[model samples]
Target: MNRRFPFDIARQEFGRASRGNVAVIFALAALPLLVGVGVAIDYAKSANVRTHLQSTLDAAVLAGARESSPSAQIAKAQSFFDAQRPEQFSAKTSASFSVADHVLNGTAQAEVPTSIMAMFGRETLDVSAKAAAASSSGGKVCILLVDQSRSQTLLANSGAKLIAPDCEIHVRTNVSPGAIINAGVNLDVKRTCVKASTVINNGGSVGNLEKSCDAISDPYAGKMPSVSIPGASCKSENYNPDVSTVVLPAGNYCNVNFSNQTSVTLNPGMYGGMNFNQARTVKLNPGLYIVKGGNWNVNSGMTFTGTGVTIYYADNSIIQFNGNVNVQLSAPTSGSYDDILFYEAPGLSQSNWVINGTSSSTLRGLIYLPSKAVTINSVSNVSADKATMVFASLILNNTNWTITPGNKAMASSSGGAVRLLY
Candidate 1:
């Protein structure tokens, strides 16, 4: 059976069918495009927040590791994180700090808020950072200057040559060019670490120079013994002996003056002021010599020798060696002041310690003056074979000075350093 329809009626039916198919195809394609755009925007927001979180955490951990106190470290970490966090996102920051066996460890964590990613049900991003620091325990330090002010805390000039091959020199000056070697001066050492704002080298050679180093704290600050002046002087007035050889016993003296061709031998004891002027020979026995509220002066031609001894200076005291002199000193091998040749009292007035001589000198111990400046000028040969440590506020070398390391074991066993771990 053949059933025919009108042309207008068939055209209308085809047009309606095509319109429905076109609508369905357009709806299917538009959905995926919208989804892709939304995902990209949400992921970009997450990535931005994650980057900020990681940077803040890293800074927080570093701050925490620098603090020596355990309680303070945690507090510092939190504060640093809060300060470094970006204001665009709300982040919950937390950190932990711990120290064991001189090693400091820090960990920081942050939960950063997400913005456009909320559509995907991801509302937060986790970021973390860790840091570690250590206080070094081994290594010999030949020189340490602990002054925070002063552009030239350590200076070598006038053709001075300092050779320290087995140790490091640490300078803690906050001024520009904290340590310098002037023209015609040569400094040869294993390492020179400075905490100065700037470093300057004029015409000298230094091996392994490190600028902006960490400050070194005193290791024996609290361990020094207290000293009290005697109520009544055991011996008073000046002692100018006419004889060639004289032996002085240990006691409390008001003022000790030796001059004019006198050969003096000092027994182990306390002295108020020991002054030697134009003396031929001076000897010190094995013990401690405490000088209080006076000046220890050795001028002109003098020969000095002391073995197994330690010299302690009280407040407002000065030690000077002028003119040509021969000195050989060694610290005690055992006791409280073991391996300590010279020690200055804490909280004393800031002054200058001068050591100048024309002849060779041998010192085998530590010379510690935490609050004073030490100047060494025009010495021929200075040898510290049994380990020697010079710790002062400032150290200046003028003219020629030669330093040789004889023994590394003479350095203090308690000596160590603190540093941040990157």
Candidate 2:
């Protein structure tokens, strides 16, 4: 011990002291780490609560927007959050709604109490959500066809227009064109076709026409027309164009308004009746209307045009014609003639119609001259507008014919064409 031990004792003692100091230093470093782990666990719980609050709020807002009733929408939104989820997170929700014009708006809010963030003074986390959703007032149809055969009334509204390109025409009582007659009860024309009407044989004996016209008074509540025809009687009755016009019936039915005009295309169908109730006004642009009906009668006061207008009747639409022809309505152009044509039905024993045009008239479609007759009524201020067409034919079989001047009177497809598709 005196020789070797004396040389190493202090050094060995110092080495042991150093190892112990190193262990103490490591323990001190781990203390901060443990605290940090504890804080991270608390932060995670707070973050999850905030996220849950956000999701619940979003769901509630969407649900409120989809509700049709105000109270129900709000109740459903609150109930949804109150429902327990697998996450078992508790949330408080509030909702509100507003409706303006056709638009609806809704908002929702959700709050969740923080579990660990309270240590940092963030007592609760809040989230907000909102959502919005809209319906229109009009019918859109590019083409409307009217069958005038059995229909004795027509009422025209403002949105409807017409295109009839040909001649303004008139016919006499004895003359018959034998073409089918397509008419409307409340016929709507946006342009101008005042010259379109049935002319009686004797300006004195318009009993049948007066009766029919009288039956269906103007749904528009406009001034009644004078019954210039002798035998015309003033019968007190109402002819309703649309079922909605049963009230406020017009008493005296005499004059019909032919200011605005419209057109309809008649395919090969046999339509017996149609009505155009004047819910609104109608304006007719320059266009053509093709019609094929069994019998034809226009309600009071409608604008019908001749520029782009043609009445194409099938066989049975026109029964007989007896009236004067007014020629002033026809356009002034070469190869133009206001016309009424007759022919045998495609598949029938005998033809059904007797159509007639008086002033510079030409006719097309089916016309029965044998059993049917067409007449052109006389109207003052006759205009001889020539009649021409891509297809023109006239058939007459023992049908009377007459002529006179001054025959009066008378889109893109997008819901089918205009729009942003996608």
Candidate 3:
């Protein structure tokens, strides 16, 4: 019974049977594509949040490092982070600030909320940033000029030779030609760095001169020991003895003037002004000499000797040595002003100081004047044994200066710079 079935009925049967299988295959293939698109959206959102959090943390840590106190540092970090973070997102932040071995370290972490990834049981993205800053204390600085207005802060005139083999010279002027060396001037140092862009060397020899360098801050400003003047017990004296040799005790002298071929020995104490003219020899005992509101002048043919001593100047005081003076001075080995020979008061206006040392001059300490300019003029054959000089400005005119490492180490008075290290 070979009976022929209807063609239309067979075709309809086949179409009905394959419709369910085709739908099943299409659904199976589309599931992976949907999942992949969902994952991409979630990951992209997380990455954006993480980047923002990281940048915010970095800024917060850098701002925090400027604080000296640990508690203040943490507070500052939190404040900065709050200011920089996005308002649309919520985040949990944790920060820590510490100082170890003179280094300031700041660390911050942020946990940001995730929107798309939350569907997959991931709710947050973790981000962190760390920073470190420190001040430097090593390296000897031969010359430090703090004047920011002058185009030529350090000038080497004709026949001048300034030599410092183991140290650097820092100039803070931002004008053109922060340092200028004229004809026949020779400036030879280990390094000469200026904050300005231009340095003028006119027919002179300069060694390792670099422009646009970092500017250093005043290290001893407001950090020096204060000077106290006695009230009722103060005494006034003018010592011009006829005798060849005279010894003075340590006390409060209002005005002191010594001259006329006399040899004077000064005990360590406080004085108003010490004026010496045409003296044969003057000696300073090993202690502190605090001078206030006066000019310390050694004029014309005087031989001065001081060891283990420090001279403190305050209130519109000046130090001037003229006409071929022989000086030998060294700083104290142990004290509040250790390795410091000369110190000036802070918050004072600019004053003039001229140091003219002869061939026999030997200064073995630090000379620090935070708010004044120092000029070394026509000085020859002077030797600095572990000596460092810091001032608001400097001028070297027709002099030959040499420095060598001696009994004490020549360290920077200004603490090193603070910079972000991540």
Candidate 4:
């Protein structure tokens, strides 16, 4: 062994050193695996942070959107984030906000620092979140439509206010100037520019109603009883014919229309189901018309005009004003006959309806005021139950309307859950 050459000994040493280096190579090979595990953990943490940030941002955005003021919205958003997480940890937080025509949109971003993964030279991971909210500052209006063609009085009796802070009054009527206009909001004669006559006070602030007296322009504006319903226990129980029966026991008369140009004036008496099928015209003189039984159906271009009329629907009584008829309800009751009025507007069909009521009368069904306003002038009590009253502006003149519990009342009190989105 001692007789070995120097070169041979060197070669053997080199081979041994190469074999030792295998361990180093194997360790180096596992470095990427460790890096991968660290990366996965970092990603998981980032995802968790992202979810949290996203949820918080969503809540904040929603809160901001509900607010009407844009500046307030921004403040609220910032407050939300501050309350959720500290600013110190939000070093790399990114946020953007914008508002356009009452619509608020925003986005949020943050960075999640990699803990174990940083040891492998990975510094941090990025996480982002976004949310949006919309604020509503649009105009809120309730159009009041009245049939001035017929002698109707627009009254403000209950504790009611206009739909908007400043509302414009417009009137164009086919009726004469004797129509009574009670002013509760304003009394400036100049403001009552509408071509109407005789504006009175409603014991409230007469804001500008007087100045806008001549504001409206347009015109004029049923019925029956028959046992047309079958499969019913009561006589008029389930009977809903196109024409319904209304009996004004003695001194009461109900309005009946036979055509648009022609109307049949009925006296206070009982009526069989009147045909509202072919553009019928009807007129009612004064007095109460009681519902004995049957449904009133309006089919085509029918018009029902009333001068002084009162209609009462018994517990089981129902009135179905069909879709095609243009019915005008006029009457002088304890409240105001102009409770339901209609005016002329562009693109609006003459086929509209006007309704009036006294103390605490419940109306059930959809009532569309296509052209004018739905004036609830009943100072004593009135309720529009299950109805859709549309107008340019909805006016709640001191018309005694309250929110009471029960199906017999309006969907009020239960949050006054009236949804008006125009």
Candidate 5:
């Protein structure tokens, strides 16, 4: 589910055209919504409460559905509704949310003080909106390719298998040789959609595929983390502690170069260019980590226990890991970035994320990298437990790995596409 890099000459020649393709795809996808909205202007011929109420309700339910916990879902929905509901109806509009069987249902009610219908003896028009959203039930995209110009954006080498039958694999590139499946590669996915064609080498097999489909647009294009955290500044130098055992506080730390035999406890906050050079045991507290720029490299004999965390990778950052390391990291269960582990902030620069950890490493979350290519070359079996959604520019698999990216059907992005299923 990944590939080789495109040549610099190719990038220069086709970069503009590729971008144009994305615009066209976006316009086409938005056309239906635009039309639907235009038809809504009449809004029962009143141009009143119901129309805006419906849109806001839809958004609230969708936001709620993205979270895993019931309380978090309801809280997020109410927050969005309160913040975005029309000001004119702020005092009159109210909404409630509930979750059942993984589906988030919401209802909004508003009383429009009739501006024109008052003469008809009706002082107020009672209106309501209902919406439902499911975060998981299959059919959601697990692996997404955002680059449209490069050939081999998705390449599955020999013995590689994409073990995601519960999700869809989308190839957005329409260029020839868009995707290649080498010998012994088996795409074990629900469906594989390609804009152009998939070249199959000897003994390559693709199950449930659709060719010549419209490119699936990036759902997390503009919803990246901020380049810098609010009220926080960059650290000036490297973190070299005097003692072998340390408990780093929740603040900005620069140049995270770890040495051998150091037992360190890192409280959640901002870190710069984390590198694990020697054997060290690192424990991460539950919180958010805003890591700005540089190589997040991990090497030899390191044990890490980090559950309930989110790593927001900003700027031109890359992830490199080696075998012989044991690490377990789980994503946060609540908040705006819930269910997401690695969130790559949008940038002009393109990068690569290489995960080459050993069998003992367990990571649970959506590795959301919208502007990078990722390669999973784990020598031994590692589980993507609880959640394992991989959103990238492209993905490569060189081993037989079973990736069940959870059962939740929501997009990795909070602003991702959501329909009003009444």
Candidate 6:
């Protein structure tokens, strides 16, 4: 030790001291950076837990809102929440619900624990969410499809436009290859929903789509007028339309054809479905017109008009109306089938029903075809005071339909919508 010089000893001591100071300075600087990183990681984990709770809370709120009683609602909400609890962060959650003014309101809170932020004394983060829902009326399904297993239940072909400001367009086929809202078709309505999970919108302006919805059952099923076909003795014989005017009584008939510019009037009763090839003018008075087995077709050269009428297709073959002239029709009010214009029998053959009319047509009321593929073609628009079309399937080809909802019964409600507040 005594062999070393005094300058050498001093240099060795300075080097050791400098190294110790540098390490101290580095530890001090890295502490803040480590804490910042830990906060970010823990905050992201808490946010992910909150997101999971939010989606689960939405489902719980909807389940509670659909219940009838307050106790039942709470039970349903609790059951659904338990069944669909998010398995994120082992969170502790609590939910509460209340119904006021026909609206179901829900609030939920979660204690989502942080992982890395625990070192900085942040043990848990508080998260909250809210939701509201209500029920709608039963008579608001306007353009509805009944099949729930078909590949393609409804299609809006090229050049098809539908503007229904207050109507409900519900397609209920839940199978794959579902409804196609193709290109060149414009659909603007109040509410448009498809039950299928595979709804394709190809460059067309369809509804703000909410797919995979619950299928809606037909409202008018098992609820229609009783059918009683008239006997041959009480039936009207063959109608020969070589005259200028003919007033038809309420009776049954078979294979009647109207031609030769004949003017006709119809009273309400059972009758065989007929064809209108060429007619000057045809009027249907106010009552129920039961149509038995036969076809109801109107060619291009027919001028037909009806108001305050209900045509019940008991067992008709087909209903195709080609419109080149004036064709006006409506449904009855203050009756059993108040808003029903054409009611196809549920037991009828699964055929096709084509309904097209002129732009001056006043075709209104509910056209219920539960066992038929309904088509609307060659028409420009369907402006009506009140109309509801329920089909097995629907097709629109090169036409436009302006479905106006003048009936308060056909108006939409807030039940179909569930909203999250915060």
- Model 2, position 265: C-alpha lDDT score: 21
Q: How would you encode candidate 1's per-residue C-alpha lDDT over 1-422 as one tens digit per residue?
A: 96657887798888999999999999999888887886677566556766666666656655654553344456776788767765445667666666543345766666766555566687877766666654344334567777776787887775677777666677878898888777777677767778886777886777677788765545455656565545555686465556567788777775777766567888877777778887888889998887775788888688888999988886767667888888888988787777788887777767787778657777887777777777777777667555545455544455444454433222211233344565
TM-score of 4: 0.32
lDDT of 5 by residue, 136-208 (tens): 3335466777678777777887767656676667777877677777787888877677777754446777766
Give the range of the ten consecutive residues with the poorest summed lDDT in model 6. 406-415
Q: Candidate 4 lDDT, tens digit per residue, 79-154?
A: 7775774233343676766654344566788877877777767777777776665423221112224445543334
| Model 3 agreement with the true structure over 8-93: per-residue lDDT tens digits | 77987889888988899999999888777876875666566667766776677656655433344567767887777743366676
lDDT of 2 at 131: 52
Model 4 bad stretches (over 4 Å): 1-15, 22-29, 32-348, 358-367, 372-379, 383-388, 392-398, 403-422
TM-score of each: 0.62, 0.27, 0.63, 0.32, 0.64, 0.63
Deviation in Å, model 1, residue 294 alpha carbon: 1.8
Off by over 4 Å in 1: 1-139, 232-234, 399-422
Question: Per model, how many backbone clashes are there?
Answer: 2, 130, 1, 76, 7, 0
| Residues 1-422 of candidate 6: C-alpha lDDT, one tens digit per residue | 56889999999999999999999999999999988888888778778877888788788877765553344556777788788877687888887777654455777788888867777688998888777655543224567788776877888888989877656687878786568878898888766778888888788788656678654556567766665656654443444555667788876666676665478888887666577767778889988887776777777766778888988887746656777756688887766777678887667767788777555566787777788887877776457556777778988887767776534222232344544433
Q: Which residue segments of model 2 deviate by more than 4 Å?
A: 1-7, 84-422
Better of 1 and 2 by lDDT: 1
Error of 5 at 209 (Å): 2.1
> Candidate 4 — worst ten consecutive residues by lDDT sum?
407-416
- Which residue pairs overlap in candidate 5's backbone? 1-395, 2-155, 2-395, 2-396, 135-409, 136-408, 136-409
